[model samples]
Target: MSSPTPPPPREVLPWSRFGEAARELARTVADSGWMPDLVIAVARGGLVPAGAVAYALDVKAMGTMNVEFYTGVDQTLGEPLVLPPLLDTSALAGARVLVVDDVADSGRTLELVMQRLRAGERPPAQARSAVLYTKPRSVIEPDYTWHRTERWISFPWSALPPVTATATDGA
Candidate 1:
């Protein structure tokens, strides 16, 4: 029997591509007519897109939640964990809040973050999530998503182009 061919390397979604996606997402959120009291960015990947969205919406107050899932090469070995510096729910109480993230992979991160945000001493009744990309299999869907793809997205850093590598290496 012949063996099946292995899949090709994942395509790189560069910063410029992410920027375009973020812009589209920002426009969608802005046109929704739902003004958020604050923008809560899921740390690390979410920071850039959230900042762009906040700027587009003219939102001032920004907060972050740091959650770590993978620690280097062992992506599947660790239990998904939320890091310290819990969000100050007091600021979100009874207000509309927008939770922003780069990609909704398995939906676990967003779901857990939303749970934490809602489980606070004072929870916001109205909370929505926005993501730049959503995988087809994502369990929890964001209220707003800029793009959807069935294939896993390889970010810029993961698949550095020759030009990017040369620039970084000063070659």
Candidate 2:
């Protein structure tokens, strides 16, 4: 015999809270006293928090590495795929990097991006990771994290419910 399936847990973040969370992550990085010369934001989720972190940390060099992992809610590809245009090594050489992402679920995405960043002859001097949330199942632990939980998170930027049909729903 088997037990019935349980519903997935959920955590919702409002925009205001999201900002605070990002600042909180920035503070964590700042406390480390290891300022990065550049910020590499994982595409999509990382974009917003990475921008906030860069602004807060006063880091002028900000770039993004697009990696497609999540296909839908609680769904993801078999493996994280690196999407181009890949970050140019011309800018990364000798730069210290702070990798930012919204969440580290399985941590595979972070792992993949790190591998890419560290590749090539002139890799960055140092690279650290920061994320708003870290899941218990994450394979890699981040250097800086605002929260650690196992619940599924609904980020403010990606949590819009489907628009209810109105008189002019699709108009």
Across 1-171, the per-residue lDDT of candidate 1 in tens digits comes to: 999988654435787787777778888987888878889998877888899888878898899988876444225424557888876788788988899987887777888888888888889879899998887777799999988876666765445434555566877
Report the lDDT of model 2 for residue 166. Answer: 82
In candidate 1, which residue pairs get closer than 3 Å at backbone N, Cα or C atoms, i.e. clash? none
Instruction: Please give the CA lDDT of all the candidate structures.
Output: 0.80, 0.90
Per-residue lDDT tens digits for candidate 2, residues 1-171, read: 999988788988789798888888999999988999999999989999999999999998899999999988779999899898888866788888999999999999998888878885678889899999999999989999999988889898888865677877664
Compute each candidate's TM-score over C-alphas: 0.81, 0.89
Q: Model 1: number of clashes?
A: 0
Model 2: lDDT to the true structure: 0.90
TM-score of decoy 1: 0.81
Clashes of each: 0, 0
Q: Evaluate residue 20 in candidate 2 and report its C-alpha lDDT on the 0 to 100 scale.
A: 86
Model 2: C-alpha RMSD to truth? Answer: 3.0
Q: In model 2, what are the clashing residue pairs, if there are any? A: none
